[model samples]
Target: MKIIKYLLNSTCLLLIFSINPIRAQVTIGSDIEPRNGTILDIKQNSNTGHNPNAEGGLGLPRVRLVNPNTLTIDSDTEKSKYIGVTVYNTGNAGVPEGLYFWDGNTWRLSVSVSSYGNDGQFLKSDGKGSFDWSTFVMPDYKYHRPTQISVLKSANVKPESYSYQRLTDGGTGSFGGATPSAAFEYLYSDELNILSETANEKYLFIGIAATTRTKTINNNVPRTSYWQIVGIDIDLTDKNGLNVRTLQKNQRLYKTAGGSDLRSYVDLFTIVPITGVGKGSYTLKIKVYNVENTFSRNTGSEGGNFVTTETRFYDINLVDINFILYEDD
Candidate 1:
């Protein structure tokens, strides 16, 4: 009876060992244990430079274990093969070196981007995860000033100059207030085609400006006059189709004082710097709204010749918007 019991007990122990049952606590290593859900675990006793990575140091792969694995070089086809592999892009003749990973469609990277702020603001480091946002005084670039811009000959036409013109005053009186003159539409846009070799929106549209002098002319209806900038408009276009920026309220230009106009001749043309110019063919033009007339205390109006004579040749400048050079990246 004792012999038979020993045989049965031994057989049961063998079966239990053969059919191993599953357990959740999968621990390894003699000293350390698994924390949780660890399918595989490894332990190293000492540190040594067993294998050097591409950097010639005992550094691990640029990224952790990735699906499909990294290829040694950049391959447009390999990207499709791997589908979801990540690798340190070892730059070649035409390729750039960077940390990138493949998704289903394209390789993505953690690219650094530019930060911007108001003129008086700058960047600061917090010695932590993020940069502290603020402003700093930039050293004056006191770089050489660029050469004066030359207006293209194509835009220097005569007939197209006075477009969208309309005298809204009902003679015998003068008035003020913006006339929603659809006149902007009448201005010739042929000059708009090529004021520059560059794209349209890239050019800054400083409105037309010229110095002027007032005189009590010997005429039946005597008056004095001056000039001021009015307003501007902008537009843009791209893959999405044509887009138009509706004109904003006209900006009023005020005289700060000084200067006498030379009779019989208009002052040299100047550019009245525009504030908010953007992308597209701006095709800037000057429109004199109110022709100022201070009468000789007696005559209420200056003959129409005053309006025609003064604004003879003041056209705005079209400077390229190359602000990207100074932009923070």
Candidate 2:
């Protein structure tokens, strides 16, 4: 197998890309030494919005912020009003008069500052901004990271249940036309079977990778350094207030200096049990925080807030991972 080794020197982490030339399949169940470095988060907000019904209350439902010093809002449904409001620094830091209400009785919730006696800073939603939904506006968010690697075996093998994709033109194709020297590739996410909520009948697997390159067909290249992953938050109830994990320690492997760099490829696979997740669907989140030397100081910033150049925070590419229910398994 042929190998390409391009050593880089910079705070910016660069992912190595290669395509081997072979037509046989190999399975890798062992852990490879992942690239070494520190992982950090670049904040992001979910456009899909959170569920307010999950947290019950008449007025503002207490919401957390990505940074305790950062500002955020949380609201709920009241008697006849479609809105309510709560404000905090996500750090549990309180802002005087930060929390307000639009009783819908005295005001229409849309009353302009001119119409209603205005307070320079007040929470007022014209029904467009406010809903019976729970929303968390975070300052720091991280997406998932996807990697492409080739496995070698003496013979051919069939892929199990891991997700796989081929390199084709605008039209899609399978693993037939690829040559040993060509960069034929596939993708898979171990978390692809997970979901946003937990349901006894529901199951999912989530696989995240870097964004696809337009010029390099079938080549996995990320434009930015980070992306977003949403799954079972594992540590919290709501999917708000982001939590970041770094795989910067993942091992790096490639074909050595004087070898053939070619092989057949397949999707990733894993074994999991279906039990104890609760009633509805659960969301699992994995995001790329920053791709740098990964060996920088202050890896886990207690500040969690990205304020200085030292705070390696950036967004990577991400896609929602899903798992469906099966009749027989």
Candidate 3:
């Protein structure tokens, strides 16, 4: 009997030693071999076929995660060893239930829903796998009208002749000697208050329509009369009356003839971008000027000593004006 037992033990040892080493790849639930390059592959035991109706699924280990910043699953020193570990968090203390993974430093929730915002608010992402509630603001639009429109009546005045006399003895002749002085008359002015509630980049649109009338008469002597509308000047100022921007349009209207009565209309519209200027009071002023209005008689034979009777009149009339403010992107 001892001899038979020794032979059996030797046979068993030989059998064990002859077996192949353990395989590096493993599969669970299915009979098919583990896929290439996979350490462990798990699949549903679908006896029918590989379809969406597969019955069984993997149930990850479930645990109550108390905190995400600290290692509460195991020994603190072992956190680095289980870096890619994942589990189903049942929640504990103040933590919410979700799927979590240990990312070497802290446990991060794989999926989370925030309960911080009201019904009308929207969810905003932090670009780092976090979300919060925020209120969406709509664009703002405002309209303003001129508070005052001052119209100056027509006036008769004798302006200098548009001519330059050549100096004889190596002297310089006067340039633009007949140009009228810059006497701008304010046609419209308005004040707009930008409150803190309307906070955003904005655009300002100004619309203006004006009419001008001029009359020039020549008593023979073959003379020519000249008149011009030197465009509009738009000035924008802040609460402290400091000029912010100045826009000018030059040489809008020009007419020259011996004797004529003319009526002209002009429309000035512009858009200005408003930025950097915070909440404050602002003012918009529109002014008009005529830099040239003169008369000159023909020289030579027509320059005979003749009585010159001429009357020049000019006027500006404001038709309509509008100021609009709207938000921009």
- Report lDDT per candidate: 0.36, 0.26, 0.59
lDDT of 2 by residue, 80-195 (tens): 44334333222232322233343432112222233433344444454432323233456754332222122232122212212112222212232232132312212222222233
- Write one digit per residue (lDDT tens) for candidate 3, span 24-80: 898786776767767886765533335653456779999887677676778888889
Clashes of 1: 7
Q: Arrange candidates by lDDT, highest first: which order?
A: 3, 1, 2
Candidate 3 off by > 4 Å: 1-183, 196-199, 218-229, 254-260, 291-312
Comparison by TM-score, 1 against 3, better one: 3
Q: Name model 2 segments beyond 4 Å from true.
A: 1-203, 211-274, 289-315, 319-322, 325-329
Q: Model 3: C-alpha RMSD to truth?
A: 14.7
Can you write out model 1's per-residue Cα lDDT over 1-329, one digit (the tens) per residue?
Answer: 99999999999999999899875555344345544545643433322247421232223245432222344345445656766566665444333445566675555653432566567666664432134357665695533232233343334423323221232222334323333323333121222322222322222233333222323334222222433433333333233434332333243334322333322222223323222333224443333332322212222353422332222312222222211111111
Residue 53, candidate 3: Cα error in Å is 22
Task: Say which candidate scores most in TM-score.
Answer: 3
* Model 1, global lDDT: 0.36
Candidate 3 pairs with clashing backbones: none
Higher-lDDT candidate among 2 and 3?
A: 3
